[model samples]
Target: MTRVDDPATTSPEQARAAFRAGTVAPTSGWAPGFTQTNLIAVPRDWAYDVLLFCQRNPRPCPVLDVTDPGDTSTVLAPGADLSRDLPRYRVWRHGELAEEVEDVRGLWQENLVAFSIGCSFTFETGLRAAGVPLRHLEQGRNVPMYVTNRRCRPAGRLHGPLVVSMRPIPAGLVGEAVAISGAMPAVHGAPVHVGDPGELGIVDLGRPDFGEPVEADPGDVPVFWACGVTPQAALMASKPPFAITHSPGHMFITDRADSEYRVPVQRNE
Candidate 1:
C-alpha cells in the first residue's frame, strides 16, 4: 500500500496519474472531508433497475450522482474522470468478478451508465470529530462488512441481502455516535443497529462476509450500519451481463462536502 500523505496536494490529475501508473490501492484516508463515492457501472439496459435498487435501499445504497451513458464526466464532480479517479475497480461479467483494474478506460462503452453512491467514509469523519473512535481507521484495516439475513427490496433483476459495516463503540459513547451520524442522511446516516449482532442475523462478529475484521474491545458493542457494498452483492446475486464497481475501500473522491448532504427542512409559516 503506497501511503500518500497530504492527499490535498494530490489533484484529480495526480489521482489519475497514480491509477494509470498502477498504484491503485484502498483510498480510505485519501482526500479526507471530500465525498468519496462507490462506483456502479452497468450496461444501459440495466440502468433503470440499478437506479431503482439504490432508491429503494437508501441506507445501503445512497445515490449521490449518476452519469449519462457513455459520459465519463459526472456533473457532481466536474472534470473528475470516473475511469481513473478511483484507486481500483472490480469488473464483473455475468455476476462473476472477471478482473481488477487500476483504470477502466479500456472497458468504457457508449452504453455504460455510471452511478456514484454515498460511502461510510463521509460519515466516519463526523464520528471521529465527535470523539467516536474507529477501530479500522486506527488499525489501518478495511472496515468489517457483512451480508445480513435482512433482504433488500428487489428492483427489476436486482435483489439481495443488505450488507452492513460493523464498528466497535465504547459503551458510553454509542448514543453519541448514533446521534452525530444520524444527522447526515446522505451517507448511510446512523447506526441501523446498536448491539447484538445476532439480532441482524450476523452470527460471528469476527467472521465478516467482506472486508477485514477488527477486534471489539470488552464493554464495546458492535454497531452496525447499512453499507454501499449492498449493490455489489446484488449484482453478483442477480448475475447482470456486465457490471463494474469500485474495489472495497477504493472510492472516487468528489468535491462535495459531507455537510451538503444534510437533509433540509422548511419550517411552517
Candidate 2:
C-alpha cells in the first residue's frame, strides 16, 4: 500500500504515474474527490441485455455511463480514456478469468461496448467525510463482498444473486451512516440491511465471496450495501462468452464530482 500525501498532483496523469511507478497499490485514496467507476466491457451483441440488467438492478449495478458500441469515450468524463485510465483490468472468457493486465489497449475491439458502474468508493468517501470510520480503508484492504441468497431482478441473459459489501459501523453511528450514504442514490445508495449477517445468508464474517474482510469491533454492527460485484456474479452465472471488468479495487477515475449524483431537494408548493 503506497501512500502519497500530495493532493496537488492527483490528476489522471498523476494517477497513471502512481500506477506505473508502483506508488499506489489500490486506488482507494489516490484521487479523493474523483468518481471511481466499476467497468464492464462486452461485445456489442450483448450490450442491450447488459444495460437492461443494470436498469432492473439499479442498486447493485448503478449505471454511471455507457459508451457506444465500438466507442471508448462517454460524456460522463471528458478526456478520460477507458482503456488506459484505470490502473488494472480483468479479461474473462467463457465466464472464467483469462488475464489480468495493467491496460487493455491491445485488446480493444471494434465491436466492444463499455459500461461504467458506480463503485462503493464514492459512498465510502462520503462516509469518511461525514466522520464515519471504515475499517477496510484503514487496513488497506478491499471491502468485503459477498454473493447473497437474494436474487437480482434478471434481464435477458443476465441473472444472479445480489452481491453486497459489509461495513462494520458502530451501532450508535449506524443511522447517520445510512442517512449520509442514502442521499447519494447514484452510487449504490443506502444499506440494504443492517444488523444480522445470517439474514443475508452470509454464514461467516471472515469469509467473503470477493475482496478482503476487515475486523469488526465489539460494538460495530455489520452493514450490508448492494455492490457492483453483482454484475460479476451475473457474468459467472449467465456465462457470457466474453467479458471484461476492472480488477477489484482498480477503478476508472471519472471527472464527475460526487455532488453531481446527490439526490435532489424538492420544494412542496
Candidate 3:
C-alpha cells in the first residue's frame, strides 16, 4: 500500500493531491469530513439510461453529480480533472472490464458523460466518530462487498442485481450506527441488513465479490450498506458499449463536506 499522510486528518485538497501524484490507495479514512465518491463514465448514447438507472435505484446509486457530456470537470470537485483525479480507473467495453490503469486520460472521449455517486465510505467517518467500530478499517483492509439476490428497478437497458458493502459492527452499536448513518441519505444512508449474510446470498463472509473481507468477530454483527458499486455490477450485466468506473475502493475525494448530505433539524429546534 502506498503510504501518505493519514487521510483522516488530511485536507481534501491534500488528499486529492496524493491521488494525482500517483499515490494509489483506498480513499476511505482519507479526508474523513469530506465526501468520497464512485464514478461511472458512459458514452453520450448510453448516458441517459445510466442516469435514469441511478434515479430508479437511489439507495445504491445516489448521484452526487453528473458531468455534462464530454466535460472533464464536475461540480463536486470544481477545477479538478475527472479523467486523472482518481488513483485508479477501470475501463469497460460492452459491459466487460477491459483495462485497469492509474489514469483514464488516455481514454478520455468527447462524447462521454461521468456520473459521480455517493459512497458509503463517506458515512464511515460518522460511524467511527460515534464509537462504532469498523473492522475493515482497523485491520487496514477494504470493506467486503457482496452481490445480493435483490433486484434494482430497471431503467432503459441498464439493470442488474444490487451490491452491498459489509462492515462488522459491535452488536450493541447497531442501533447507534443506524441512527447516525440513516440521517445521511446521500451517502448511501444506513445499513440495509444487520446480520446473516445468507439472507443476502452471501454464503461466505471470508470471500467477497469485491474488495477485502473481514469476519464478524464473536459478538460483532455484520451490517450491510447499499453500495455505489451497484452500477458497476449493472454495467457488467447490461453491457453498455463503453464505460469507465473508479476501481472499487479507489474513490474520487470531493470538496463537499460529509455533513452536507445529513438530515437537518429545524433552525428553531
Candidate 4:
C-alpha cells in the first residue's frame, strides 16, 4: 500500500503524482473532496458503442468526460496522462485481460478513446458528512464490487451484467445513505438494492468478483450502489480488440469537486 499524509488533506494532484510514481492501491479515501473516476479506453471504432452503453445505463456508467482518439489528457485532470496516472491498469486483448500494469503509455494505441465515468467514491465524502460510516474505508480495503445476474441494456455491440459496489450502512441510516448518494446522479446516484445480496445472485458476501470483501457490522444493512466499474463487465463480455481500464478499485482522481455533480435534494423541514 502506498501511504499518503492523510486522505482528507491530500490533493488530487498529489494523489495522481503518487500514482504516476508507481504507487499502487485502492483509491477509496484518497483526496476525499475531489471527484474520482473509472477510466476505460477502447479503439475509435468501438467508442460509440461504449458511449451508447453508458447512455442506456446511466445509473451504473455515468460518464464524466470523454477524450478524443489518442488523447491522453482529459479535461477532468488537465495535464494528467490517462495512460500513466492511474494507480493500476488492465490491458485487454480480444476481450481477455492480457496484462496488469502500472503504466499503459507503451500499449496506448493511436485510435484509442478514453471515457471517465463518475465513481461512487466521489459521493463518499457527502455520506461521511451525514454520519454514515464507510466500512471499506474504515477497514482500509477496496469497496466490494459484485457482478450481478441482472443484465444491462445492450448497446450496438456491448452487453453485460449490472455491477455494484456494496457498503454496509447502519440499519437506521440506509435512508440517509440513499438520500445523500441519490442527490448526486452523476456519481451513480442512489442505492440499487438493500438488505439481500441473494436477490442479486451474490452467494457469498465474503467473496467478490472484483475488489476486496468488506466486513459488515452486526446491525448494518448491505446497501448496493450502481458502480462505475460496470464497464469492465462489458469489456469481458463484448471482447473488444484492444482496451484499457483502471484496475477495479484503483481510480483516476480528478480536479473537480464532488459538489459540481450534486443536485440539491428537497428535504421536508
Candidate 5:
C-alpha cells in the first residue's frame, strides 16, 4: 500500500483512477468533501440476509446503495466499477479471510450482489470543518477499529459482535464532535460510546482488532463510532461461504457529496 500526498484536494474520479491503476492506500483523507463507502459483495443467495442484517443494525451497517446480482455499477457513483475502483479488497471463504487483493474482477461471480455501505469517512470533512482534530490523519495512520463484546441483532444466518472505530478527541470538543456527526445518520452517525474501552471489552486501545493503533494525546477522550467493518465481522462469525469486502480503511470513494447524507437541522425562530 502507498500513501497519497495532499489527498485533500483529490477528486472521486481521480482517486478511482489511481486505484484502478493498482495504487493501494487507505482512503481517509482522499477527496475530502466526497462520500466514501465500505464495499461488500455476497452471492445472490445471501443478498436478503445482507439486506436484513443492515436493516437490523443501521448504526453499524448503513447501506447507501445495493447493486443487482452481478452488477458492478452503483447509483452513488455512476460508471465506477465496484470490483476495481476500491484501493484494496478482502476475499472471504467459508468465514475466513482467504486473501487480500488490489482487485476482485477475476474473482467476481455472476451471482454476487454488492452493497455500498456508508462510511465514517464521509462525515470527516464535517468533523474538520467543526474544528475536531483527527488524530489518525495527523499521525498518518489508518483509524483504529475494535471488535466489541456487544452483539448486533441477527438477520437470518448473519450474526456477529459489533465493531467500532475509535478517534481520540479533546475532552472539551467531544460534544461538538457528537453534535456534528449525529446529524448524519446515513454514515454511522454519532458516538456509540465515549471514555472507557474496557466497558466495551476492549482490553487495550493500542491493540485494536482491525486497522492500525493510533496514539491519543493528553486530555483526549476516546470516542467510538459504529463502523462499516461490522459486516466483515459478521462474515467471520457466521462463516458465509463466500464474500468480498473493502480492506478496512481502504474505502470506495463516491461522487456524492457529504452534504447529501447530512440531516438538516431546523432552528427555532
Candidate 6:
C-alpha cells in the first residue's frame, strides 16, 4: 500500500501541480497536514440562498470560504486557483450533472461565486495521528459516501437528504476515533452514527452512492460521518440553473493546517 511520504503529495502546491498536469486520482492521504475542502460554485443570483443553506446545515456543509463573485482564488490558499487546483470538477446545470472537467477556466464567468466547504478529509489527519486506521487511505480508494433518509434544514432553494461518508473503525477504538475527529468541528466534526448501515437506509455497505467501498474487518464497525457531498445532493435536488463542484474525493487543498481547526469535543458516545 502507498503511504503519505511521497514528496509530490506532501504540499498543496506540488499536489495541485500534479492535478493540473492530468493526474486524476482521489486526493485522500495527500498533503497530510494541510486542510482539504469541497468546492461548490453558484451564480451570484443564488449566492445568498447557498450561504444560508450552509449556515443552517453546518455538519454536512460547513462553510469555510465564499469567494466574491467572479473570483477564482481563496483567502485560505492564496496563489491557488480554484479553477485549476482540484483534480476534477463536477458541473451542475438545473440540478443535473452536466459535465466533468479538470480545469474550470473555460467555465469561469464574472458572476459566479465559489464556496469552500469543510470536508471529512480534514479530520482524517487527526484520526491517523491518533493511530486510527483509515481503510480508504490504506487501500488507496476514495472514501465511500451515501445519501441518507435524514433531511437537511431547507434553505431558500436548497434542500435535500443528508449524505455521509463511511469509514470502518475497530470496535474498541471507536471512542478514540470520535474524540480525535470531534476536535475538528470545522471539518464535519465526528461520526454521526457508529454502527448499523440500515439505520441510514443503506441496505448494502458494499454499494455506495459515491466512491469505492472498503472491506470491514471482523470487529470493525461501519461508522458514518456527515460528508461534504451533501451539498451536491442539494444541488441536484434544488435544480439550480448552473453550478460547479469538486468531484467526489477531488478536494481543494489549502495552506492552513489541521491543528487550526481542531478542538476536541467532550464525547459521551
User: Higher lDDT: candidate 3 or 5?
Assistant: 5
Per-residue CA lDDT of model 3 for 108-166, tens digit only, reads 89999999999988988888888888888888888788999999999999999999999
Candidate 5 at 133: error in angstroms? 0.4
Number of the predicted model whose lDDT against the real structure is largest: 5
Report the candidate with higher TM-score, 2 versus 4: 4
lDDT of 2 by residue, 1-269 (tens): 33456633476456755564444356666567667788998998889989999999999899988888777776767866787667788898878889988777788778889999998787666777878899987787878888898999999988999999899999989988888778887888889999889999999989998789899878999999998878888888888888888887787777787777878644368
TM-score of 1: 0.91
C-alpha displacement of 176 in model 5, angstroms? 0.6
Candidate 1: what lDDT?
0.83
- How far in Å is the alpha carbon of 254 misplaced in model 2? 0.8
What would the TM-scores of all predictions be? 0.91, 0.91, 0.96, 0.98, 0.97, 0.95
Model 6 scores a C-alpha lDDT of: 0.89
Model 6, residue pairs in steric clash: 183-263
Q: Candidate 4 on 85-140: residue-level lDDT in tens?
A: 99999999988999999999999999999999999999999999989999998999
The TM-score of candidate 4 is 0.98
- The parts of candidate 3 lying over 4 Å away from their true place are 1-3, 265-269
C-alpha RMSD of each candidate structure in angstroms: 2.9, 2.7, 2.2, 1.3, 1.6, 2.8
Report model 2's TM-score to 2 decimal places.
Answer: 0.91
Predicted structure 6, TM vs. truth: 0.95
Candidate 5 per-residue lDDT, tens place, 246-268, comes to 99999999999999999986546
Off by over 4 Å in 1: 1-3, 6-17, 264-269
Clashes of 1: 0
What is the lDDT of every predicted structure here?
Answer: 0.83, 0.82, 0.89, 0.93, 0.94, 0.89
RMSD of 6: 2.8
